[model samples]
Target: MEKHVSVKMINRFDTCSSWFHHLTNKEMSVKRLYRTDACGNRFCPICTWKTAKKNAIKISILMEAVKEIEGKEFLFLTLTAPSVSGEELCDEIDQFNKAVNRLFKRRNVERVVKGYIRKLEVTTDQEKYITEKLYKRKKDYYDWRGLKVGDPNPTYNTYHPHMHIIVAVNKSYFGNRDAISKSEWLEMWRDCMNDNSITQVDAKKVRATETSNSNAVLEIAKYSAKGSDLYHSEAVFDTFYMALKRRQLIVYSGMMKDYAKKFKNGELDRFKKENEDEYTHLLQSVWKGSTYDSKLRELTQEEMEMYNERAKFIEEGDEVE
Candidate 1:
């Protein structure tokens, strides 16, 4: 019923990667297969999963860096106001981001938390969306024709947008006598938003694991919105595109802001080590719609020599005289 890019999105996903290269070392072990032609579309399920995994790894690197520097602590915070309609979604998010900025600017807030990373998430309510559509007698319209929104609780649900935040702090934040309490945080958020109706706020310490990475950061590194929500209907999809397109969903503040710049410079990014001396060759595979048909074959002597020469050239990074 609405103008959307669903057709284009479907086409993009259908032809995401037609070929995959399987690489193996001299040890005869398959190093993971390589498929680099991903469409990189945010809505593509395949690309979204890939992005999430990469982000999780990069964020873990950041957490590990923090851990190395005197064992800094982390806290996962969830702030909610109220759901808004698709029409109001974009502006609502703008206000949400502003309120978060206002909260961080507070002397009290700045005193305890060191740096933070924030992620914005928008979700749609399919069941309630349809039920309400009929109730409002929307005559085959699009753009959430007569959707009811702004209700903290709804019969089904509406377009619910919220923030998932992770704040890094010093070790003494929790043990100090002047530490902030749970109720105080709720009040501060309400004041920042200028909406006393904001009652559902959650803040908790990130529990430590044997690994350097904290599990709480995964919540921040995940997708900006649920795939199920967008694929529910054209209206939902269009609304999300309009609301989130060109918006900065991930945010870093204070000391974390410096880390963000470092991240892009590859300082905090993770890369797999490739050994050129191992003499690895690639196995070619072609996609047959659902599955990849392996075209495995032992390399001929000539092919092996070619692979070695290419690897040597790459390692040397110079042309032969």
Candidate 2:
């Protein structure tokens, strides 16, 4: 007799029941949704690109907004540290800002120095992988848009969440030419990273090889204006809704069936122990209180196809407006 392979069927309604039961009876529900469709390829890539482009445009606008102030020079400085606990990371950023601000005041250059610190938290896993990859390859990993081949690798090993300080130096001292040399800026950055304490860490003069191209920036800007409107369009919203519905159906039919079998076989405890945290979090994110509904009203299939076509054009760098 030949051994047979058996395929199992999942009940969608049962999956929902299990999810509901877990939510009502579990000790604690997960607080965060680790999985999202934001990265799904089935989703419009143009919409994704547009969102990023819009953000860049917004930042540029904000930077230019402060440019009109008389006697001010913009300074862009990045502060980095080794990856640590999340709370500690946040504290380090706060301390860095305070130290940098104090240093500016103590220097008393007599120009109105005003600035803000934007903290970017790098998760440990991502930091570790990036650091290791850079170390092994001896290459500096610039932003996606700025990436290039054959660059010297960053020396830092650990993922340290860091802060970017956009300082506007008073014109009376630094001058309007943005006269601060890269070395001077790096020293200040290193000092701030060290929490103003003396350390053996040498402030290496790393030249920024990346150059900003206005054409690339403008191209991004143009796509962003088109993408934003398309994303909120009825056609796009319908596609999103359909995808979400399909995902929900698959999870319920397949995942719930397996859970029920284990529960009946007195193996539920073992399975639960292995995936309780992840399952709880998923349920909380998907069906915690409110049912999932389309944010935009229904659209014709033709409109949906058109939105997707526009998205394709944007991704290919074609002229889109």
Most accurate candidate by TM-score = 1
lDDT of 1 by residue, 126-205 (tens): 55444544445433333344434332224244677889888888888876865677788899999988889876788888
Candidate lDDT (C-alpha), each? 0.69, 0.35
lDDT at position 8, candidate 2: 21
Residue pairs that clash (backbone atoms under 3 angstroms), model 2: 71-171, 138-153, 139-153
TM-score of each: 0.76, 0.34
- Candidate 1's C-alpha runs over 4 A off are 1-13, 25-29, 129-157, 210-214, 266-279, 297-321
For residues 1-321, what per-residue lDDT tens digits would candidate 2 score against the true structure? 011111221222113322221111123433212223332222344334544454344334333433432333444444455545433544554565466555555453223345432323232332223444544443333553354444433322222444344444454434435355555555665565554432222221112221122332232233211333234545433423332322311111122233334444644332221222222111223343556421222224564344434333122211223
How accurate locally is residue 248 in candidate 1, as Cα lDDT from 0 to 100? 77
lDDT of 1 at 181: 77
Show where candidate 2 strays beyond 4 Å: 1-55, 68-73, 85-87, 108-117, 123-132, 136-158, 170-179, 190-321
Best-fitting candidate, measured by lDDT?
1
